[model samples]
Structures are given as structure tokens and as C-alpha cells.
Target: MATITVFGATGYAGGHITDEALRRGHEVIAVNRSGSAAAREGVTPVAGSIGDDALVRDLAARSDVLVVAVHGSADGQPYLAALVPNLLKAAAEGGARIGVVGGAGSLKVREGGPRLIDTAGFPEAARTESASHAKVLDALRAADTGADWFYVSPAAEFGAWVPGERTGTYRLGDNVLVTDEHGKSFISGADYAIAFVDEIDEPAHHRARFTVAY
Candidate 1:
């Protein structure tokens, strides 16, 4: 079984990934903000912040895979772009593969058209965070972390509002917004976790970014 370390184990996507990893019988080190955090069964919860370089390196040293599903502080700071590079450095030091939960803002709606974030109805409040996520992807793509780094962007319609059921089916895409038959782009948290853990089991699309949607 793989030793997976999840940095945002208490967050929405990270929580799902932690549970999914445990369900598959993998050892999970769930990192959160509080030491008293109760993650889930079979998960070893470690309270810490992503800003600590030593803490991140130590965790990555003992993990085969490191998943970064964290955002910034509660005050809405954009630290993802900053933390990712540090995570990449730690992963390289520990020789562990890194996977980051990216955003659909960097993904194109058409073959060569503008990104989804540039399209209509994109929330103004979310613009900064969305741009930060895209910047993280850009940093990852340019980093020389060898063969153990990847970024995964969810569909455009994925969020806390759309808590759909798990159908155990999804399709992967490359920097493109994935939509269904009716042009709806969405994926359930459970299903997205399924895809994330599946990638952990089978190392495909390395040193790159991919998307998952129904």
C-alpha cells in the first residue's frame, strides 16, 4: 500500500481524498490546522500549516505520494502559488510524487479560445483565487522537479454547491473544460476523489496537468 500524505485533509476535496485513500486501504497522514482534528477512521491526523518548510519536508520524506489540496488563510489570502513551489521543493527532496488540486480557470473552453475564467459569469470575488491557481499550474509546468509532479483541474461546474452522487464514472481531459452531453461541466466530490486516488494507484500523466469530469 502507498503512504499518502494529504496536506488539506480537513478541506472539502482533501477530506474526500483522504477518505478515498483509506477506503482503498492505503496509509494516510492527514494534515490539518489543529492537532485535535478528527479526520476519519484509519487516518493519522497531523495538525500543521503548509507554510512550515521543515514540517512539509518531514512529511514528504515518509510519503510515497503528497497531495496538496489546501488553500490560503481563512482571511482569503492567496498563498497557493507560494505554497506549491515550496511543496515541489519538499517533494523533490523526499523523492515523492506531488499532485495538486488545480482550478478550471486555466483551462480553455475552446481549442484555442480564452480560459474558462475569462468567460462570462465568472465570479468577481473569486477572480484573485482563480488567477492564483492558474499561476500555480504555470509554476509547476516550468519547474524542474523531474517526473514526480502533476496538477489536476476540476470541471467548471465543480464546487460545494454541486454535491452529486458517486456514479464511479469520469473522463479525463487536458487543459480543457469537460462538459457533459448538455454542455454541463460538473463532477461530484466523491467521484473526483475516486479519480484522484485512481491516479495515485496508477501513475499516468506525470509532470503535467489533467482534468476530470462526468
Candidate 2:
């Protein structure tokens, strides 16, 4: 199994992803602020920040894949600006692929239509964060050819607030949002991890962004 290093391992999405990786017999390096991720087999908890270039490079070098499940900010400061560059360099140095947990804001409301973030009635509170994530996607696209990466944007109704049960099924899409027959887009955290880990197991959509939903 691939050795995966996951940042933000204590967080919702990362936690589930880490667990799933362990479930599949993949070794995990769980990085978090406190390094207090639940004690579990196959997990090596690391207390570190994504801002630490040395630590990131070290971990990236040691693993087959680096998973970024963090946000745009760290310690109240903008982090993505440096994160992408650091990851690119580390991935190149370590020959490891990068997997990012991206935001849905960059996904189009429909084919050839405006992005969801630009649509009317989008949550003002999430505007800044969403826009930042969109930038992350752009940064990856513009990264050097040697940098191998893939981004996964969850459905609009994703997050800890709705901890829906895993149904062992999900819909996948390209840069467009995936919605159900009633126009609702959603995916439980567990199912999202399944999709993420499945990609880690079998490479697909290299250097591209994909979305997951019900």
C-alpha cells in the first residue's frame, strides 16, 4: 500500500481520509497542529504546520503521496500562497504525487456557465474562502510539469454540519457540480474519503480537478 502523508489530519475531512487509508492498509503520517490525532494503528501522528517547509519536504520525501486537507489560512495568516509552491517543490524533490481537498466554489453551476462562487445568492461569508480555494486550483494548473497533482472539490452541501452516513456510492464530475434529480448536491464525508482514497490507489485525472456528490 502507498504511504500517504495527510495534513490537517485532525480535521473532519482529513480524519476520515486518514481512517480510510488505514482501513485499506496504507500507512499514514497524520499531521496536525497538536499532533494529537487519535491513537490508531498504521498512523504516525506528527505535530507540525503546513507552513514549515522543512517538515513538509521531509514528509513529502518520505511518502508516496502528500494529501493537503487544510484551508487557505493558518495561524490567522494566508497560507495557500506559499503552500502550493512548497508542495510543488517537495513533490518534485520526493517524486510523490499531491492530492488536495479543494472547495466547490470553483465548480461551474452548469457546463460553460459561471462558477458557483460567482452565482447570485452564494453565501457572502464563504466568498473569501471559496475564492481562495479557486486560486489554489489555478495555482496547480500553472505549476511546473514535474509537479503531479489532483484536486477534489466536494458537493456544495458538504462539511461537518451535515455528517450524513456513507452509502458506499457517489457521483463524480469534472469541473461542474454534481446534483441529484431534485437539484440538490451533497456527499457524506465517508463517501468522499472513499473517492479520495480510490484515486490514491489508482491514479486518474492527473493534474486535474474533479467533483463528488450524491
Candidate 3:
């Protein structure tokens, strides 16, 4: 089993990823700002901010895969820009595979055109958070580190999605969105976790970004 480290262990997406990692029999280390109590048999909780370079580096050095599921605040906090690069650096030094829980706003809507966030009918309240995500993507793309990293963007309607039965079935897509036969783009959190852990086990798409939807 792979040694995995989840950066934002208390968040919704991160928590689900942690559970899925544990269920897959992988050893998981959950890193949170304060601390996390959602303990499992094989899950270890590490308390520290992403800004603490020493602590993050120590955790990264011990893991094989690092899952970044951190979300910046809507009030224009510079945490995303600051933390991700540092984590990426540590992961590179540790020779670890990086998996990012990316935002849907970074996904493209057209070929070499604007993203989904810029398109019409997008909610105004989400623009700031989306922009922050875009910035994080830019930083990751421009990074020169030599680590295998995959950024996974969930469906447009992803938030507080309850888990369905563990069918282990989901569709993957590239930069563009993925939709079902019913013209819907959504995946349950459980299915998302399945995809995430599957990628962790067998990395088919290396150094690229992908999405998941039912």
C-alpha cells in the first residue's frame, strides 16, 4: 500500500479522500491546521499549517503521494498561492506523486478559450474563489519541479454531495467537462473518492489534469 498524505484533512473533499484512502488499505497521514479527530485504524493526523515549511516538508518526505485539497478563503487570502508552491517544493524534494483536489472553475469550456468561470450564467459569488483556484493552477503549471502531479476537478455541481453506494464506476475527462447520457455533470462524493484512490493506486494520467463525473 502507498503512503499517502492529505493536506486539508478536515475539509469536505479532503475528509472523503482520507476515508477512501484508508478503505483502500493505504496508510494515510492527514495534515490539518489545528488537528483532526476522524481517526481510523491506519490513518494518522498531523496538526500544522501549510505555511510551516519544516513540518510540511517532514510529512512530505515520509509519504509517497500528497493530496492537496486546501481551499482558500473567499476574502482574497493569499494562502492558496503561498501554501501550494511550498508543498509542491517539498513533494519534489521527497520524490512524491502529487494529487490536487482542484476547483471546477479551472476546467476549460472551449478549445483555447475562456474557462467555465468566465462563461455566461456563472454565479457571481463564486468568481473570487474560482479566480483563486485559477491562480493555484497557474502556479502549478509554471512550477519546474520534477514530481508527478495530477489535478482532479470535480463536476460543476460538486459541493456537499453525499456518498452513493461504492459502485467503483465513474467517467474521466480531460480539460473539458464530462457529462452523462442525461446531459448532467455530477458525481457523488463517494464516487469521487473512488476515482481519487484509483488514481493513487494506478496512475494512468501523469503530470496532467482530469475530471470526474457520473
Give one digit per residue, the lDDT tens place, for model 1 in 89-155: 8888898999888888889997988998899988887787788888788878877765388788998
Between which residue pairs do clashes occur in model 2?
none
**Residue range 1-214, candidate 3, lDDT tens digits:** 9999898888888888888988879998888977764776998888887668898788888999988888854466545865667878888998888888888887876568778888898888887787787777777788877777988898887777454555678899989877777767787777888899899998898878899988
Q: Which stretches of candidate 2 lie over 4 Å from their true place?
A: 74-77
For each candidate in the order shown, give its overall lDDT on alpha carbons.
0.85, 0.90, 0.82
Better of 2 and 3 by TM-score: 2
**Evaluated with TM-score, which candidate comes out highest?**
2
Candidate 1, pairs of clashing residues = none
Candidate 1 error regions (>4 Å)? 39-41, 72-77
TM-score of each: 0.94, 0.97, 0.92
Higher-ranked by lDDT: 1 or 2: 2
**lDDT value, residue 154 of candidate 1:** 90
